[model samples]
Target: MYEIVAGIDKSEDRGRAIAESITEMPLDHGEVRVTLLHDFQDNPEGASVDQVASVRHARKILEEVGIEVVLEESSGEPADAILRLADEQDAEMIVVAGRKRTPTGKVLFGSVTQSVILGTDRPVLVCSGDEN
Candidate 1:
């Protein structure tokens, strides 16, 4: 079975974008499995991965298309958690949502998406968070 680990943040738009991109793939219903991963750097409320809004949105979309979905939570740096989880899951690919940032902005604020792409040897799929 083909395996994919998707790292998603709290943005609903990013989740939707990721889901839509996955749905566009021409895989059979049961041929692939997707793991939705959320890294909680700080969670005072003690929320689970499934409780994340973006994760939930992505889960619904993926489930509707008959794809197997797993929700996993990690607590630490997002890129590190994502890479660790992807390795643990032995995923064939990694998926992440990208934010629109200027070069200066990226320089000021390091991007999790950028980190994931640079840190992984496996294939990485990046989906845009913007609607348009």
Candidate 2:
């Protein structure tokens, strides 16, 4: 089976697309299992809400294609939490959905996607978010 860890932020559209693309990938002779991860920094109340929404979105999309799905919510820096979980789970691939940002912007704002890409040796699939 394919073990995928998808780190979702505020981009629901791009996140869903990433999940769909992964689930659709031809698996030769195995099934796909996805762990939808949403890292919530302090604020438990708001974090719970966001986590629920993210899990719901991932479940709705992944389940429709008959892919097994689960939710993982953690506290800490988003990128760090995702990387830690991926390592712990030995995920085959890491997924993220975020907007494109220039190097200067990324440096200034500190991008979670970029951090994940640079931090992990695992293959990272980044889906561009929809323009809003």
- Which lDDT tens digits does candidate 1 get at residues 1-132? 899999989999999999889988887858889999988988999989888999999999999999999999988899998899889989999999999989999999989999999998999999988756
Model 2, position 35, has a per-residue lDDT of 85
Q: Which portions of model 2 miss their true places by more than 4 Å?
A: 28-30, 42-51
TM-score of 2: 0.86
Assess candidate 2 and give its lDDT: 0.79
Q: Return the clash pairs for model 1, or none.
A: none
Candidate 2 minimal-lDDT segment of 10 residues: 44-53
TM-score per prediction, in order, is 0.95, 0.86
Question: 1-132 in candidate 2: lDDT tens per residue?
Answer: 788898876566777777777766776313878888877666645656335665677678787878888788877799999899999999999988877788899888999888899999999988766667
Candidate 1 global CA lDDT score = 0.91
For all candidates, the clash counts are 0, 0
Give the top-scoring candidate (TM-score): 1
In candidate 2, which residue pairs get closer than 3 Å at backbone N, Cα or C atoms, i.e. clash?
none
